[model samples]
Target: MVVGARRVTRLLDAVQLGMVVLVLVAPVAWMVLSAFKPRTEVAALPPRLVFTPTLENFAELFQRTDFLENTVNSLIVAGGSTALGLLLAFPAAFAMSWHRMTWPATATLFARMAPGTLFLLPWLMMFTALGLVGSHLALILTHAVITLPVAIWVLLPYFDALPREIIESAEIDGCRQHQTLLRVALPMVAPGVVVAAILCFVFSWNYFLFALVLSGFDSKTAIVASFNFIGEGVTNWGALMAAATVIALPPLILTLIIQRRLVGGLSAGAVKG
Candidate 1:
């Protein structure tokens, strides 16, 4: 009976693991499948698992809109925001770690937890007043709020985990504070920075609300441009899915390439602490 019960538990555990894999893969599989189907086939009363696949949706996505340009815009916004946020957040994270300050970190947490809408109105009004509305700067600035917080938080734990003795040794060796940070501390925390950068890039790339409100025609990201798929006359499901597939490719490829490093980076501070 004990052996029988153990076998039953193992079988149940296998089933649970399979369910978890399905939960994660199902949405992505559906999206890929939708991107290939015809509009009618997508909404076919009884869903068809297989059909005639066509590239017509992709052709339409590229031909009917500025999809390529918007792709470049997403790259710029995400790249720029991640870089700038890292620059600003690194110093702040270092200070917070050095000082052992919790209030400052808590304040950042509060900002992140607050209703996003609450800040939007005032930001819009201020941007409009400054003639910054509908510009890349406005979008970049709003993204910094998101990117900076994430970068700071990710870096904080790593910074705190570093040896105070090492820092003191560097100081004794006549390294200037900033020099120590740049040469000694930063390299040790580089993996954490990379993890923070990846998170920032993904968040900035996927961000819709700020781009939708703040970006002009020249600066609009692929995510906002995909909105064109929803027309007043009719929604083009196939075209929308195709655009989504194309828009998601950059980050997807990016994540796949760096996934190993990202995993390592995330584990760095935890073991040290």
Candidate 2:
């Protein structure tokens, strides 16, 4: 009876894991597969998994669009936002976690939860008035809104998990808050920092709404440029999927490279926070 129960438990666990994998991967698999298919095959009612694949979609993506330039723009904005967000969030998170403050962190959470649209008009007006519209600076600074909270929240528990005795010893040895963070706590929580950076870069890189409204032709990101594949009457699914595949690659590669650290940081955060 015990052996039978154990078999059932294992079977149930396997089924649940398979379900989660299917749910997460189905769309991504379909998109990647569709990226290689011709347009007709992409929209075919039954979907053509066995069809001959072609590179025309990717060819057209590069041939007809400024994909490379947009890719550069995306890299700049995402990289700038991630750097600035980490710079600001690291200290804030350390203070909040070390002091066990909730209100300040909650305030940032509230800011994050608020719709981007809520600030869109004000940001537009403000930037327009300041003559900073259409600038990379504007986008980088604005994208920080999305990246900052992610960095802070991801780093919070890592900071909180630090040993109190070490922190006290550092203080007793005349290490200031910034020195302790830079020389001590920051180095110890390096995994958390990498995880936070990955999350920030991914989120900022793929962010759409703010980019759509705020960005101009020169500053447009690959994500915003990918929308050109859609039209009022007709949509290009093949090329769109191809562009999406390209856009998804960087973040996916980054995450895969550091997946162990990401998983460890997240697991620790869940338990410690």
Candidate 3:
């Protein structure tokens, strides 16, 4: 009787897990399906479970709009911002770890705690004065704020976890501060770097509000361009989904490739053992 009950419990747990997966995945699967289906098939009364897929939506998405340009803009913004975030964050993480300082880390933490829009007006006005409004530089600057804090926060633990003996040894070996960080410390915390990069890339890719407010036609990012699908007369659900599908692809592919490194980045540099 006890064995039978244990088997039933295991079966129930598996069923629950399967149900959760289906619930979460069903809509996304539907969206991928819709991105390929013709308009008529998309809204068919009962829903078409099966149909001949068409490339028309992708073809239209590519040909009708400046989607390729928007994609390029998104790539540049995301890539540049991620690079900026990593550059700024790595040092910040190291400083906080090395000195056990609170103020600098606290200031950065406060920036993350603040609502994103709080900085918008000031940033906009500054950009306007600098003639950076609606430019790639403006967008990159804002996106860097989004990516930087996340990277630092994610990397902090990894930095904290490093062995202090290594640092002492480097000092004993005639290494300068920068050389210690570069040669003695960095190699072991590589996982954290990879994780920070993946996260920075994903956040910058999906960040819409800043891009929406900051970008112009030539510099408009894909997230901002998807806004075009919402018009006064009617909303093109099919095309909107199509645009969304395309917009989501790059980050999805990137995350898949870099996922294994994410955990290491989160835990690297976390402690001095």
Query: Which candidate has the highest TM-score of all?
Result: 3
TM-score, one value per model: 0.88, 0.86, 0.90
Expressed as tens digits, the lDDT of each residue in 72-183 for candidate 2 is 9999999999999999999999988888999987888798888999999999999999988878889999999989999998888789889989989999999987899899
Q: How many backbone clashes does candidate 3 have?
A: 17
State which candidate has the highest lDDT: 2
Task: State the lDDT of candidate 3 residue by residue for 1-273, as single tens digits.
Answer: 999999999999999999999999998888888888887787787988889988788788889888889999999999999999999988888988889986876688788888878899899889989999878989888999988888887788788899888888889989998898888777878888887888898999999888877899889998878876665322545666788888878788878877666655446535432
Model 3 ranges off by over 4 Å:
232-235, 258-273
Instruction: Indicate the worst ten consecutive residues by lDDT in candidate 3.
Output: 264-273
RMSD (Cα, Å) of candidate 3?
Answer: 3.2
lDDT, model 1: 0.86
- Relative to the true structure, candidate 1 has a C-alpha RMSD (angstroms) of 3.1
For all candidates in order, the CA lDDT equals 0.86, 0.90, 0.84
In the predicted model 1, the residue pairs found to clash are none
Encode model 1's per-residue lDDT on 1-273: one tens digit a residue. 999999999999999999999999988888888889987798786888889998888888888878888888888889899998999999899989999987877788787898778889899899999999867778888898889988998899899899999999999999998999999999999988888888899989988887877888899899988875564333777888898898888779778867886777558746865
Candidates, ranked, lDDT: 2, 1, 3
